[model samples]
Target: MRVAALWFPDWPVQAAKLECDDELQEPLVIAAQHRVVVCSQAARAAGIRRGMKVRHAQAAAPELTVIDANPDRDGRMFASLAGSLDDVAASVEVLRPGLVVADLKAAGAFHGGEDVALEMLVDAAARRGIDTLAGAADEIATAVIAARSGQVVPPGESAAYLARQPLAVLTAETALAADADTVKTLGQLGITTLGELAAIPPAAMTTRFGVHGAHIHRIAAAAPDRRVAPELPVADLAVAITPEDPIERVDAAAFAARALAASLHERLKEAGRNCVRLKVVAELETGQRVERVWRTREALTESATADRVRWQLDGWLTSGGAGAITSLILEPLELMAPDAVGELWADRASTDDARRVVERVQSQLGIDAVLQPRLIGGRGVAERIQLVPFGEAAPPVEEKTWPGAIPAPLPARLGGGIDHPASRVTLIDATGKPVIVTAEALLAGEPYALAWGDKKYLLTGWAGPWPVDEGWWASDANRHRVARLQAVGREGGPQGDVTGWLLVWSRRSWRVEAVY
Candidate 1:
């Protein structure tokens, strides 16, 4: 197999700074969650380096501007670049948040061999204002190093080619540094070449470096048994977009969605598929994401996909708009090959027809307006069934049943109707132990004080303090942490009704564990 490894050096730091006020071409570095993320070539020239302490980095280059790395944004943008490559390659596999490897056996041969394919990739990436280094060899590992080193190894000579490279290239360490004065490159090792490295006793290497040392030996030797699978075809298409201008207005975002949908349509067409799962990514100027996915039918036209994008964008904009919009992307998670027109009878629903229904409903009602039940763990009604995109795999449900917990329903809607008519309740003395709430005080009487908001109110009527229990066997039961109470309103309502349900809100509901 002709394997190629494409490397995007410093992609995260570069992608993160794209939206910053600064051009980011000079000495720059990114600190992610308060640790060194990456530094530019200029920063390296200034003695500032990747993984350096933030304070130390500043000390090295006083003018260096630092931006916190946004991993999510960088990941989505990298995915977009991968999706764009689908137009030229048979498959595009994402490697982490930055790198992607494209199989060239088919695409390369069709494009006039490997050199042409590499050049094509360079051109494609250049159009997006990206600089990438690519290299090809018989073994995937050899290609990875060549791409990083900006060298291409000829086929059938990977072992000889890799022998001259440094051992640091194969080591998995993210921060490349030497431990001792005797530091030597892979080429300088006793096993002077890859062929020699392969001849080293595997048991000895394993004892010395554990599994990692064994892996290094295998890569150096060009292990014949190792297999690099072709890029896995995307199970579902997903997309995200960032606009050239900040979207301050809601309607303006709608216009951006139209463009994104058109782009997605082109991708789907090239993939020979139609989609039911549509994901919309809205990049906020704050650098946070307002993303949601919905179940829909196969989208036959670019316009249909655009309509769904418009719906999601409008929903996000109207729901507080999240300050400003930067970009939008549409992805189809559930997809099928588009059907031939007039292939089926009118009474039957073809794949295309089903896809159309999904798109229409998604376009009409907002994407969030329609939901599919996904099982989740929790004793609360709202915590049980999760809303997810239709046709997508439901998240695995776990056994979180507490011995005496209230049985909750799956997929509960919030703030709709009460079991009974309007009622009222009140607090008396509102202090500690066996807290008192009197009926008469609520039935046209006044309470001395209220606790939560520290406000006083007149009581009218009363309801039972419904008790809820959870995690009976755990330590939570002893702490009074497993219980919840629901109370009616003391005042503040049209006819004095409960506005919110108060619960101890168990921590288990927040951490969901899924079985693979």
Candidate 2:
């Protein structure tokens, strides 16, 4: 297959500039995890490179403007660019946010030649104030490499073209790259070019580096390339809803869209397929129709599809150009086998059965009636658990190094609930004075006894006044400055059973937070 690759260099930087109005003339870099992932031409000129520490980049370029890398922002901005390529190619497969590969033969024939087709693609991107490099070769890997320098290899010269490229090209942000260890080992062994790597016997490469070695060797040899899997034809998977009344409000439209999304997903699940692209169609009350195609790098889940539908409807209904929506339809434009992405363990039949049962219950009850507990990032145990509606994706939890989070060996039972009375308790010192956590986060006195309602327990062992100050920036009503203590107590005689208590000192009172 003759494939063509279109690449936008420094895509994250470009996306950031477009979305945030960052000056392209200035030195700019997109940093993630304190390391530079992408840098603009100006920044590169100043000696800032990808994978450099943010601090080091700043030190190299005093005027460097650093923006946090956001994968979603990059993908969102590139969607339009990928969609535009459909005008020139029969089908476009986005390799990443800023790179796309497609079968070049048909487009080349239609546009007179491959060169003209590539030029058209570059021009199309140029029209959008973006610079794009395009290249075509018999193999997708070779074409991607040639795109870096905007060179097109002759139809039968892909092997020759790849032979001259450095082995480092394998690491050029493409799916074809070998792992870092493999590349490093090869470089150490004096295999610094694709030709050198290809010189080794295929069996030798396979024995030495396993599957990855054999794969790259084939690319270097320009063997028959893998066919580009484009978006599948919409088969009969389209699901639609026509509300009895014109859906003018966003809430009502969302309700209908959720049901439609669920139905579409059910059909896909039955077929053992997933969709990467979705086409949302809305027919307005005034006979006007509006539609849009939303694409993702991964298959869209049920919640994600519903969110896109709701967002599309909201935009249409809120705009004065469109009237109330009378009909909504969702169509899966691109389909793939479920395993194309990834799958869970093979022994998940019981899990699937449980999911089906939960879904049936959700259908009978309201969507909100069923809830699932999700672990979130927080300092306290109760704060870390969030209840979300079943079947919907949980909210993304922020990655944080919670410095003062509670230690493990979490309590076996929580102490606060509407149905259960508050397990209010008091901790007293040896002299009978209430134990307190001083402002300095230190225990004022050792806990000697635990008082709960009419029962008093003698404390045998205790630890901590581990303190956590949270939400200090919020209003006083919302701020919390509390301390916790773990204590073991005996209720009756010396032979009585021992119980562990998790106590919290808040609002100048001791309360039972949990029991173990």
Alpha-carbon deviation at 161 in model 1, angstroms:
0.8
User: Which pairs, if any, clash in model 2?
Assistant: none
For 1-516, candidate 1 gives per-residue lDDT tens digits of: 776666777886656554342356567788864557787777889998667898888888888888777644564455444544655666444434455556667668789888888778766665333457887777666777677866778878888887777555654322111121112433456544455666778897778554445767777777652233332356555556666678766467657767667566656656767765455667777888755444332243555555545545554554453567777766555566654554344653345455545554454444554577765755545455678865454545666655543333222234321221221222453332223323331222232322333333333433333334434667854643323334334444345433333322233211111100
**Candidate 1 error regions (>4 Å):** 19-22, 127-129, 172-196, 203-211, 225-516
Candidate of highest lDDT: 2
TM-score of each: 0.43, 0.56
lDDT of each residue in 1-516, candidate 2, tens digit only: 778888888888887776655444478899977899888888999998889999999899988898888865676566545645667876566566677787788788999988788777776666334568888898877888888898889878887888888989887655565555677789999999998888899999899877667877887788786566444556799998889999999789779978998899888877877787777778887887756666654466676677667656665665456788888888888887653212334342235345545554454445787899888877776777888988776657788777877788988877883123467788889999888888898988888988888877888999898887888999999998889889998886456678998888887778788888
Name the lDDT of candidate 1: 0.55
Worst 10 residues of 2 by lDDT: 340-349
Q: Please, what is the whole-model Cα lDDT of each candidate in the order they appear?
A: 0.55, 0.77
